[model samples]
Target chain A: MHPRLTLALTLIEAVAILAYAISGFIEARKRRLDAVGTFLVGFATAFGGGTVRDVLLEHRPFYWVEHQTYVIVLFVASLFAPFVLRTLSRLFSERALLVADAIGLGLFSISGTSIALEAGMPAFTATLMGVATGVFGGLIRDVLCNVVPLILRDSRPYATCAFAGCWLYLLLDHFDVDSVYSLIIATAFILIARLVTFKLNVRLPH
Target chain B: MHPRLTLALTLIEAVAILAYAISGFIEARKRRLDAVGTFLVGFATAFGGGTVRDVLLEHRPFYWVEHQTYVIVLFVASLFAPFVLRTLSRLFSERALLVADAIGLGLFSISGTSIALEAGMPAFTATLMGVATGVFGGLIRDVLCNVVPLILRDSRPYATCAFAGCWLYLLLDHFDVDSVYSLIIATAFILIARLVTFKLNVRLPH
Candidate 1:
């Protein structure tokens, strides 16, 4: 991956982590869980996907080693969880969750695919890793909450967007396209596809 | 390992897989998810940890391969999920979930440790595999559900029991004890300890 692309991914990752952490905090506080619940959910919601990606790729010490930003983001998110949750009733909705998660899915798919290519994984494997990284965290968080996974559910386009964007990235890479161009194309595809599907109730075939 | 112990594990595993699959079905139904949702979560609830363990341990085909019984069990559980759930609900509660999960923890820890040893992994690495085998399934399920992981949380004893059992098994194996005795001792130790912890609401100190 190009240096500029790498930098772009780092920034997007930072934002995605922060966004998901906030979502987790809001969820925990709504349950009236104590501090531990907030932090635990926040941590999982933030790092779960990336951690799974890293471990599967056999990356040592994990991604948390390079950046403490995710941890800090979760901490900061947890601190304001109570206050934010109060206003969440106005600002948060199913539509909002879809948007935030879609943004996250785009960032994670790009980053995971980029890392897999850097690690010399095959294009198909890279795409699979990208989709896994983008979606598995929320899946884990949902399962623990005793809810149906968003990705596995019939009514959601979560994994479908990730899968589409991942394939786009890999196909672009195979053509030796510029990293930034590939990323922009893939991210836009994911975000637009996700938003449209959510709004229209489009779902994958059974 | 003795045939008796193997038989015992197989029986427990069959029940556990069916039980977990049923839980997944209940959640999927609550969301009004389609057949895909029911099957996917059922698989995750049953095979998530084992898949993670096999992938991590570099074992191919996975445990669900030889014993297709697990698949049959998951299918049956899904088909009759509504009836099974009504019956299960009368018996299932927070306490029941914990107990069933604890049984899975012990069985997974013991069997995973034994497999690691058979593969000639180092003792510590074997222990790690044991823990991974025991926790990864629930971790996957929780991620799918988009909630905080119980293993990661301070909620009761989970991974620690596996760790202790791993070490105990290692010690017995190192002393050249019969593998049968070692497995029995380790599994019993973990199951009893986990049950006690759940009963007493014992938890790890932060």
Candidate 2:
């Protein structure tokens, strides 16, 4: 495994934990769910993607076991988000969700690709797994929140961004690029692709 | 597999397909989803567990490939379900869901355990895989639907039923019991145990 890539994945994991935790809290408020319900939704959203990947790979002890702090962080963030994010959303002209979601897509895609490479899967499968890992958490979050999946719908470029970014990462690595350079380049592709798609209202029909 | 056990498992699979398909379709309607959405949800509910099991085991072609009828049946059923199941649910109650889920659990647990044993996995690991095959589908579906997962929630016999039934099936098979007898016995154990838990509102706390 590439050490720099591992560090990058950890950073992305932290970002995702924070973003999903906030989103979960916001959705819970929209549904008028109780505190327990809010925390549970947040918790699922935070862990859903990585958990699925770990299970698929037969990775023992699971990633969450080694990093229990992420859970504790999400718990605290969710508790505070309702007070901060909800109020800010009412006042800000910009949409916080779109940016946060884009960042999350980038982070998750990068993390997923790295993990797949670590497991020694081929590039094609690694790209698919990466995109799946990035988007699956949100897929699950939407389902539990009683909404349609963002990925299956022609709603936006959510998964496409992940796919594109992962491929770019893999392509660069094939050329034996520097790890940090590849990480930045790949993550930028995801972030930019997602943001551009969202801004232009792009959607995939199939 | 015992010839007789195979037959019993077939019956259980059919019943499970119908039950989960109905539940999936019902959830789709509640969300006002399109026909595609309805069908996808139904398919996931019916075959998601087995698919996950096959993927984990690196089994080629997957279960649905051999049993293409299962997918077709769910597809056809989804179109008519919104109308048919409402009337049916009124009479049968959610008990149908429980019974069907239990049947699937029993069959899947047996298949998973037997496969793992064949592969020479340790008994503990084999048992875990068996439980996963039986229960992981619902967990995946719940995540997709964005609802608190039934398995992880502190309020259900859920995975416990699968876990218990897998061991029972293993013990019976170890004794070279008649395949048909083991199938029937294991299925009954899961179904009765599951139904009783539901009627009594049994659940484990986190």
If you superpose only chain B onto the true chain B, what TM-score does each candidate give?
Answer: 0.85, 0.87
- How many steric overlaps does candidate 1 have? 19
Against the unseen true structure, what C-alpha lDDT does each candidate score?
0.74, 0.72
Off by over 4 Å in 1: A1-11, A85-98, A120-125, B1-50, B54-115, B118-206
Q: What tens-digit string does per-residue lDDT give for candidate 1 at A1-206?
A: 77987788677667677677776776677667777778888788777888887776676677776777668766765777777666765777767666766788897888788997787666655776787788777666665556665567655677668878988888897899988888888987898898988788876433
TM-score of chain B of 1: 0.85
Top model by DockQ, which number? Answer: 1
User: Lowest summed-lDDT stretch of 10 residues in model 1 chain B?
Assistant: B60-69
Per-residue lDDT of candidate 2, residues A1-206 (tens digit): 68987787677657656676667777777878776777778877767787877666655676668888877766666667567765767865346666666777777777788887887666665775687677677667676677767555444657667877998998899899986678778987888888787788775432
Candidate 1, residues B99-154: lDDT per residue as tens digits?
Answer: 67667777788888888878788888889988888877666655555567556986
